[model samples]
Target: MKYITKNKKNNKQPRTAGEKKIKTMDPALLQVRPAMQESAGFEATLAFSDMPVHQLLKQNIQNKGYRYPTEIQERAIPALLKGADIIGIAATGTGKTGAFLIPFIEQLLHNKNRTGLVVVPTRELAQQVAEEFKALTTGMKFRAACFIGGTNVNADIARAGAKNHLIIATPGRLLDLVNRKALHLNAIEVLILDEFDRMLDMGFINDVTTIASLTRARRQTLLFSATINASQQTLIRQLVQDPLTINVSSGKSASSTVEQNVLEVAPNENKMEVLFNLLSGDSFEKVMLFAETKRTVDNINKQLARRGVRSDVIHGNKSQHYRTKAIQQFKTGHTRVLIATDVASRGLDVQNVTHVINYQLPQTMEAYIHRIGRTGRAGKKGIAYTFIN
Candidate 1:
């Protein structure tokens, strides 16, 4: 084995090892270069500004203090407005929901009595989309409902019946609603699948296909995912027609905005110390922490409690009421920290989250992106910190 040697006082390694002894370099000879260009982080850009529909929609955005469109929003919104099927590949927090929602709302506003369907991978996301739709469509008469697990199915159906022109639902519950004859998809003109890749990863492909078949054949479809690689081609082909694919790199591994760092610690004891240090600082107002298992979620919550820090936990093992309560608490600022497995962290809709801490590294880089996305949502500046070893 041979090692490359560099001259003293200068850090550059010569192109050839023989060059080291050939020249006496000046003091100013050292020139350093990075392997890649330093990232300025992802910034939001407006893609649909001057269009008449967006100009009408811009008033709602400006009133909310959202001056710029995120990358996903910039790219996905125009295709949606053009009546083109969209396949959006963007990071978790790049305002994807709005990218699809704003145009859907505008279309619905133009054609009354026609409904839209948004299928999400999780209950949290279903609720989040419903809330965002409600917020953005304020003062408008359009009604929206959320059909997800844990809530009263009867109530969701009633809400759907009363005035819902748009419904955000999870696959299982939505299928259940369809089976019970409580909902009809034939009237739905717009169909959206948010976080479609996660739904496939969760084994919802069959359910999604079945649900899609229920809609009318001429319906407009929109699909959003963190990555739209070849693996998703079949699903993509089945749902969308001649789709306009927009790949905005917003996944966990690629986000330039988040300064990702991993902390090395012992198996269990050092975890709290790392968390406390990150949280005790006044700079971060909201933090989302991820664990690999539900048991870890409980244990970490207990640890935080003992440390006199108020935290909430949500996972598959928790009851629906508990999960909903935890989310509500976190959203209202009653709890600054929410601890859970990937279930709670992914597809969670909380804006202005300043930081995301991975108590454990996920199995893949994509999961890391989705977990961190909860913080840097809607083009807001945020950070993600991870713990390793």
Candidate 2:
């Protein structure tokens, strides 16, 4: 890739930096590339049947077409089955959901009445966890309630009263239901916070804490996040007891399979036009454009639509129905591009995404990683570009 700079033009890959503050328009910083390294490794001697889980779970695993356990699943399932508190750090698409679900399902099979709760950062994530739980417990007699915002409160209340073995919920709606006496979590045996750090990022820490406190009988607390900040040390301690930290992705990094680069927007150049020209390329199929705010996403969607490009937008401002429909349209290839704010960074999972473009630089590196991770999933080669204007 070539870059245009104020001083001169070049075709060099920029050196990676360790900046405390981002320098978005630095001419010397032409491209931002992630250092490639093996994520992590473990002895994979056990198959689904070899693990000491129920036969039904083995069958379910096979039915899902999961041939082998990912690193997190392999390391977490054993300890979790023993009812141990754990802090799991793995990248996106590493099977973190299955790691917790498989063991917890085994726990449910042994004792049918015991209930568990999974708290996530987004409504979409809560829905996904519930769906994963359903798939894992296909033949088993397990029941679950999913409570999220942008849905009918009365419906969640009715479902909450139905003797469920598990509850998957987003923190705000979950806590609201608890305060309204619609949901009872006092006797819950296990509590899981998926995308744990993202909850902190979204300012849902207090809500999650209150929900965790309400689940007073939680014997095992499982925390999973793709990236962990050292500043969250105190919060992590409060969540888990004598926790085992598992770093399957080693530390903070983007996917190795993603080809990371940057686009230089010259002082006089029109960035929107530059993006339009880039997307016009034959290689730019099925792209995700990440903008800083809802208004920006919507503007981009409008611009793309006017230029005869099929696209959809999702953000916190959109209702659940709108966001769900937008994602479905993008996922099904009905839309060639999906424009989004940070809300879709964690929970949005679409397969075979050809490219991810950061129209605006993310506030933090962790957010950047989550944004690019939407592509390069399931061991597929993908591309990510950050536009430097």
Candidate 3:
């Protein structure tokens, strides 16, 4: 396989005396070449066949019934395995977690005492990543500690102080631990900023920058996001060094498999009535509803319950136990609807979400993409209905 090398002619000059000179590769120029398509109904070509994956991971992949890698996974796994810092841009539900986790765990298994830090924007994402890491590292000696807000800080400190191989955390809690001297980033060999655009949207830039400054300068960094903007590009330039940019999509934020539409409500019409009407229909088997604030999420969940809709709610104000329970109930099919704020937009990975309803549109287009992304996962057809008041 021929790889695209960084263009030396596009290198950017150093801005200051002590600043490191960086590459100026245009994101448009760095695209992942399309791989051979698989025959209809047969397992797709395995991109990892030629890569140096562990025998145990190979068995796990087979056991989990993974036949072919997603486009991002196909391109990213090999580059990450080769120890290249990468900036991966792919839509949600494109198997990004596996793309990064596989190579990360492989490196941990191959090297001794090497620690990896995966910083995400929300607690749900941190937990989801930790679960994926656990699934991949089953029967291995690696230990992962999940540090997020709302959990006991002392317990988190104990876990961080232990001999853990992986640290999956949100920025605020991780920075708190670091400030307390309970967790150190000096030993980190691998650093990943998953859903980084969301981190920027959530106003975590300062904390993320501080945490990155704490880590060793020579570590490998992998940054993944569905969309990259000018501010994000500035951060990428400051963080990663001559990174390989892999873009799988043609810059489409939302998934193509999702049928998106807007339900316009007249001036005098009640938006809740329209929502109730849609919920009464037979088209929805499982649904996710997004609102703009915690109070709005609670009100919607309450209104849905009063109107005989079995639903739950999650938000920043809820305790960790309540949020986890709500997610589990939604995932197990016990609830037909899960109403949430933008907090659920990023990394809530429930399966079979037949419909995603925007009771209110998100503040940013990126959040809308993530909210709709909850559905249409795993190549399944889904619908996204937005209520426009």
Candidate 4:
């Protein structure tokens, strides 16, 4: 007997099938305003001395070659050390990671069992945060477990089962572990939502709400973002208690140190040709190129290879091993050019990135800021080139 299956019409359709859809900013939200200018010839000379940080942490800070703190760090560290829930509004490359890490490390040193949880939007950011924690906690007896996607579940389960003083993770994986009872949030004394805007932009609000609800009610919650929208404000009002608000960015666009320009190309002109022309210049050393899709990134990498351009590509399609290796190669100058999607826009901190080329414009102005932020970091001069067609 032959059996026939009836097709059911579903009202809810998946937004995407195989590849991830590129998120676009609403045009109604796009109004070009004058860039907020910083005071000329005015320098912030704030050192970390006045803060209530522990002596051991101070020693670690000096050892890490950090003498003066960035504006956000200088302001946030004091309150964080005082166990204050804070809402930090700062742009990328503003030492926001250090602002939160130092206080958390100091807190863990006093009480090892008081777990600290940091939820980020991307795996790269998680890895970077973990590295920062390790660097600051050097020679200290503290363990950190990083939970992200595209990794071994059994290994993560084992790591989570171990008594970790610090936990850095992406929302989905952390929520999965929590559901499986492999990780407990009840003992979490500190909860940090880094890049909260990015999390909201990536549609992880539900997961974030669930995870935040699972944590201790009296936890010291810190939410950091480039911009705070209405949704993020609502979340903050619900999650934090009498939060100390700090906005060091002052509504700035990309870094003023970066020379921004646009190249106009005709619709019939091949973007690869334009990119090749740009890469042909000697000044394009240590460049990062941003594309919109994994297929586009791969294609650009392959084309650059054919033309003998030392380039590497990273996106969701590649395994974690390959992605990490590519980033390392790019960081070590083994690869002159790195091609990526928006995945690399946030939480990618590579030094000496001389140029950031937007092969295609990002869907939102905020994303554009992050993509350009990969360069002009650490008070270094860099250039941002955007292609217009």
Where's the lowest-lDDT run of ten residues in candidate 4? 1-10
Candidate with the greatest TM-score versus the true structure: 2
Global lDDT of each candidate: 0.73, 0.83, 0.80, 0.82
Candidate 4 contains a number of clashing pairs equal to 0
| Residue pairs whose backbone atoms clash in candidate 2 | none
lDDT of 3 by residue, 1-389 (tens): 01222222322322232112322223232123121233242244564555579988877766667767888888899899888999998878888899999998888778858788999999999999999888888889789999999999999999988998889999999999998999999888889999987898779999888878888744799999877776677888888999999987544457766777766565556667667878998988899999776777887888889999999999999999999999999999899999998889888888889999987756666677788889988677678887654
Where model 4 places Cα greater than 4 Å from the true spot, the runs are 1-42
Relative to the true structure, candidate 4 reaches a TM of 0.89
Model 3 Cα RMSD, Å? Answer: 12.5
Local lDDT at 83 for model 1:
89
Native-referenced Cα lDDT, model 3: 0.80
Candidate 1 local Cα displacement, residue 105, angstroms: 1.3
lDDT tens digits, residues 1-389, model 1? 01122122322211223322323222121112011235565565543455447455667766767677777777777778778988888877677888888888788767777688999888888878888888778777778878898878888777756768888999999998888888888877788998888899889999989888888744689888775556878878989988888878733244555555545454434446667767898977888888777777787899788988889899988888888889888888999888988787567878677888876667655676677767756545577666544
Ranking by TM-score: 2, 4, 3, 1
Query: For candidate 1, what is the lDDT?
Result: 0.73
TM-score of 3: 0.87
